[model samples]
Target: MPDDTVCDMWEVQRGFDELGRPLRDITFCVVDLETTGASVKAGDRITEIGAVKVRGGEVLAEFQTFVDPGTPVPPEITALTGITDRLLYGAPRIESALPTFLEFAHGTVLVAHNAPFDTGFLKHACADAGWAWPKFEVVDTAVLARRVLSRDEAPNCRLGTLARLFQTETTPNHRALEDARATVEVLHGLFSRIGGLGVQTLEELQAYSAKVTDAQRRKRGLADRLPDKPGVYLFRDDRDRVLYVGMSRNLRRRVRTYFTSSEKRSKMGQMVNLAHHVQGIECATDTEAAIRELRLIAEHAPRFNRRSRRQRRLHYVVLTQEPWPRLSIVRRLPRGEPGIGPFGRKELALAALEAIQETFPVRTCTDRFGRVPTRSRCLAADLGTCLAPCEGSVTPETYAALIRRVSEAMTVGAVDVVDALSRRMTIESDLERFEVAATHRDRLSAFSTAAMRSSRLTSIRTCPELIAARRCDDGRWQVHVIRYGRLAAAGVIPVDASAPAYVEALRALAESTDERDERTTVEESETLLRWLESPGVRLVDVVGAWACPVIVDPGGPLVELAG
Candidate 1:
């Protein structure tokens, strides 16, 4: 202990105690550090450590030293620090410096700006000296500046800012001892602002410091992954448990979604944060990825999955929605359809969508217009591809046909869905809904590219299929079937396969209304295939022998039947 120290100002005995009796109080050491760099891990080394001990608000003793780090001082660091090599030419090493600083700070709390860096350096120094680290509390003035003082008064809580604000002409050098003394002055301004109550305790300051540091690090960009490709991914915890499952086409982009700045507040985000790690499965194509994703979601029943309803039991069924029996996706198993389970909801949706694309397919998903409308120009119309339903280039029934195919494709088929959409696109273009035509065109293009790249189709554009049933007030309940590649909805026909010219009459009925009905009756889908292969006697319902117009293969006029 130096008797001739500069910090001997705070030791006067006060007359008033808690009960108004003469009392003695301990000192607090306002400390500071000069370091070669910011980090404390391996390379950064401390240059100096200084402390000023004060008792009852008056300085009692001073401790300061320049430690000769074994490493050479970096020139850039020396420039910023203003502590050149010559300053430490014969200074004592950390081994000699730590014990002196420890003795000065022994009975008092240690206060500093961003105190962790200083305290951590001291701990390492103590560890080096074979002396056990001191068990003392710490206080960071930065925390107090934020919580107690008005932000405007301490806009920049740096030491220089506080010095200027307090009107203290104490020119701050990067010197450790000088900075320690300047901080004591800064402490006065800061304490005066807080009414000297020290709103935050030493432990609170350390916790605040750790939290702030972590928040800053999180802001610097290792927290999110953003890639735009189709793929499936998994979310796992630190223990390697697959806590959740997810799929995305853009592998990296999808993974980065969890870190969206807005998402952290969501419950899903809390779960994502809980997941300590993630892994991804890349697919060559998006459609495949979409299928795989659906399958995975169902299989895992992940806690954070977005689409999970009606994921299973996607089979051939009917909905009684509109007067014309507007086709809808069948959620429950009807007479047909295969097994469920295995995939997430996405794959389940795809499975039903595939069957409809293949069988009794027709346009189910149409514009607001029942018929395809005609318009002068839309984005699609302007591009010379679609007939805008809004302006009426497409007739209601015709538009309905196109929608039927899209709707049916949604419920059935395994073929590349883009193909069925392409076929519907061609139909729309032929009918003049150029805007819709353009979308179908784009969809077809994407499908063509996808089908080419991957050897699989989401759904194929199979011949449209038709389901006929008697109706009450509504028109004949015809469910455009998903017996082909993709499902499509079309106009209904109320008919009974009986009488002399039954087959001929039905063919005429299907053909006369073929503009819309032709999109129905996908006689080639597995459902129809199985149906046609059944042991029912083939009766030729001979009307006029009209050939199957769209049948490119060696077949005669499309026929209907009677016994």
Candidate 2:
């Protein structure tokens, strides 16, 4: 039988110090069991249970119990395990013994020679008793042995053979505690082998034993230099070309996954196979890390990063420059000209244009030079939809007043626009014009979305610098320094830091950042602005103030036709 003291003496030395709890710090519940038969589905029952709770190779506790089978112990089982009805007389039943064993094993990883057989029986017992089982990370010495030991060293990885080959003082004798003790020694031996391969944490140890290819295993060193923090990582090929870019709260853990069997995507497989090096860019906060990832993806245009590789299609609503300024949808805004959108879809942009046309009698004709048309008015003028500016019916000053209202509605998120549309819908419904009411409702939604976008864009465009902070869940303040809509600098300040310390950090961060405003695109600015406006963030300071004018609510009518 396995030596109780030998299992007690086997201690695993520590491994890499990157992320997560070190292997030695983890507690392991080494378990073993003897059953009435081989298969639980065939009505087999556990006869005895043995488990050793160890941390850092020191025995914390031990549990062993005989479970009354409530039936005859088969003669073959009695022969193999030497457990019989006589020995189990008046013993606690399987259901009764499980709770105490589970309590002993709580919050520790369960280790067994053949984990499936041992864990499966325990899971069935829990199900039978209707007890809620705690989530436990299970480790199989059988599986670990296969990865760590060669067939030449041990023809098979059964408990007896492994114990003998590893020269454990104890051997498996079909009894519970002796076999469990032997398995513990085997576990320590395998851990030592994997520790040399850089398996340092419980998570890493589990992931390393997965069905990773030899080629992938050879490249594990690629992740050795990565920092264990929230940041972005770039996977590069032997040619020094970026293959993929990803961000994670734990950079080393995430990068390691790319070369492990856990990466199941075909593209990911190809990327890892070609990857020769990994580069990490550490960030102060997860929010900053995410934003930096967006900026980097845009700049590098990595081939394997399918998303954010191309600019998102955006449309704008601009008032055409003419004596009679009329609303139009455009792809690009003219420099120095005011516009309403970077709308995500052409359909939404068109809807906003139609909404403005329906509410105001702005001229839609393309004519210029303030000349009255010799021809009769077009359909829009004939229907009083326009002021008939092409027919010289409206003065430029009067037309300019109407255009000004449109600008106010779009840029400042003027409440007048939404209120007007709401009232128009209500009036049309009261008049039983359901189709007109529906049109007004759709227009209001489009208009509100556009107004919100315009407000966000305008706030950052007007500011030379914006300093904002949000309290993180960890009690650190996430500080963002933005200049002209682009992220300039970001850092985390301790919530308990003094005023002077905070000011010095802000100054240092600002000085360290190089302005890349020229490379800032619409998406980059929008992403930063969206985060700034998110629920948790509080705007602490601003270099140049941003303000929006109050708009008088237009509640009287939906369609005001005056020119």
Candidate 3:
């Protein structure tokens, strides 16, 4: 059994799996409001409330009322809405009418021609009346009309225009109940058009009506058959070339967003336009899904994906192997060599190298020296920046000592180096050399970040095999088999099965991994390390040693600098 704390963490839901209720089964409350003014913040109040609830094209109920605004209705409002102050003399005030309308619209999808206008006023009324507003899924028929109908089909998205387009029995006459009735007809007409594009669920309808392009809206059919499961998805062009790759806990919902206004990336819109099909590969665990995404992105080199494609170009700061060793940046780390990084950018690697040089007396010159010392010194040596090892002033043994210190600082905890740099920073501050102090602070930060990242990657990569399990929201256990920081296999333990036996069987069938194969990238290892440290993850088994070095103080200057 896991600890009480671990069991308590499992109560937090991971994600939703079920796709929303179907449109035919959902009840829609089409609502409209006549206001004293357009702006809710400028003391506008609802003068009339009207709504019609329908399910499967059948009217279930109707709610209509006139509210007393306590302020005189303007002549313009009377001319527009035909609502007079005398007619509202004996009507209920908004404080009394709001709760009654809310009760009628509760547990139904809220629909209106221009939803923001009506919904905004109602929200303000709820706030003013000291009543908590309910969370209702709002759908705007006007927005949906713009997405479904072109200018040739409908000149405008107004209630009267749509009522004429749909040829509804009730024409909008600026009256709340009549307009709400017309909007109900418009909503059904829009649904009929969207149904041809494979939108049968309320979630799909809401996404289809969002501010997406016509090209993207037409691509909604691509995500119709995707499963609601944890997996990787690929967007393929007409020629079957992958355009983009991604992963999510709910593949269908995540892929559907690519065609919705929620995806604001301009490049994604272009990709969706070019995509001819979408494919989903379901996985048993989210960890497996993440690793598969990284592998697929690396293998496919999809044009739209920006990360993990150039893993070969990652730079590392290494201490060269020579009689007079020096710090150098390389794309590939030599085997059996101690290094400090797998930085994504050369600039970051250079910064980490600079930080190491600033603290230790490591030589900065890029020269190949032999056992016989060359009697030559560079400008860095002349300025006392280097120990002048090439000039034969410093013996080979003394230089070796400096190399050991630098290597220890890179691999082990850099406690002494951090303390030395902190003291130097204080002295520079005392002398009022703020620019120099700032430079030192930045170098220290870069070094600390690189060291911490390398430690995390190394800890995961050095382990031969590791098994872990996390209980899902549905009471099933998601088991993962990881070898050398790569997902070897994955499975799920049923609620009635023993988790330990299931994990053991998975480990027996896991892929054989070679720790020295160089197939595991630094990003993949870091991804595994993060999963291993996340809440609710229980270690089931381990083969080799796994631990990270605690190098920096959590509340030290590094934290302050990061802030």
How well does each candidate superpose onto the true structure, as a TM-score? 0.33, 0.81, 0.82
Instruction: Give each model's whole-structure lDDT.
Output: 0.50, 0.77, 0.82
Ranking by lDDT: 3, 2, 1
Show model 2 residue runs off by greater than 4 Å. Answer: 1-19, 284-288, 330-337, 350-354, 361-393, 424-443, 468-479, 491-518, 530-541, 546-563
List the candidate 3 regions with Cα displacement exceeding 4 Å.
Answer: 1-16, 19-29, 35-46, 52-63, 68-85, 92-109, 116-137, 145-174, 178-203, 211-214, 308-313, 382-384, 496-498, 554-563
Q: Please, what's the RMSD in Å of model 2?
A: 9.8
lDDT tens digits, residue span 388-436, model 3: 7877878889989989888877766666557767787899999999988
Q: What's the lDDT for candidate 2?
A: 0.77
Which residue pairs collide in model 2, if any? 1-171, 2-170, 2-171, 3-170
Which candidate has the highest lDDT of all? Answer: 3
Give RMSD to native, each candidate: 27.3, 9.8, 5.1
Candidate 1 has a TM-score of 0.33
Name the weakest run of 10 consecutive residues (lDDT summed) in model 3: 5-14
Residue-level lDDT for 300 in candidate 3:
90
